[model samples]
Target: MRRAAFGLFGLLGIVGLLPQAHAAGPSDYSILIISRERLEVATSCEIGVYINDQLAGRLFQEQSTSFNLPPGELDVRLRYLPGQVPGCQPGIENQRSTRLQLAAGQINKYRIAVDQNGLTLIRAGLGY
Candidate 1:
């Protein structure tokens, strides 16, 4: 009887740990950055995604322009296309910065407007 009770307790412990183990999968949050203007202003722009200042990934205009970052607070920055002439306007350059606090299993959407005035940044998240 004692051995049976111990085994039952062990089984219950294993079951309880299963959920936690599965939770270790990739973060459930996604980052979507879009330019508000229809024109391809950022012809060769590079977007640097950082989580708490640690470089997560760099995306170019031609490749996966959007990114999926781990669920957490992030300080994202968009660097101008190298060697490209800077726009005269304040927000015209590709360099834009924004901060976001993301929750687990959430989808975060950001709209960045780029034009003669530089870049305007906005963020919204769902599924906190």
Candidate 2:
């Protein structure tokens, strides 16, 4: 009887730990931004993600390819090297800003345009 009780307690302990062990994985939300026009990808251009005006992360031109963010509301700013002319400057020179509300376990896509002033347009919707 003692051995059986010990084994039952061990099984319950393992079952309790299973949920915590399985909690680690990719973020619950994702976003993708693609350029609308074909331009030389700038090496210095960066995409900044802000949560409640706080700096969350920055993505370079290549890094802007995709994003995995927590489920919440975020203010996203895509800023290029300010004061530089497009195609003439050494880095990107544009800016685009938008807000997003992400739901848990949802993937969304936003088609963005980067011009002289920054992200000029954002087409956002659910993703497959």
* Tens digits of per-residue lDDT for model 2, 28-65: 66554544233444444454554456656554444345
Off by over 4 Å in 2: 1-27, 34-64, 82-96, 114-118, 124-128
Give per-residue lDDT, candidate 1, residue 47.
Answer: 48
lDDT of each: 0.54, 0.56
Each candidate structure's TM-score, on Cα atoms with residue i matched to residue i, is 0.44, 0.44
Which of the numbered candidates is closest to the native, going by highest lDDT?
A: 2
Q: In lDDT terms, how accurate is model 2?
A: 0.56
Q: How well is each residue in 22-70 modelled by candidate 1, as lDDT tens digits?
A: 4565547655554333334445455445445566555554443456656
lDDT of model 2, residue 8: 100
Clashing residue pairs in candidate 2 (N, C-alpha, C atoms within 3 angstroms)? 94-118, 95-117, 95-118, 95-119, 96-119
Model 1 C-alpha lDDT versus the unseen true structure: 0.54
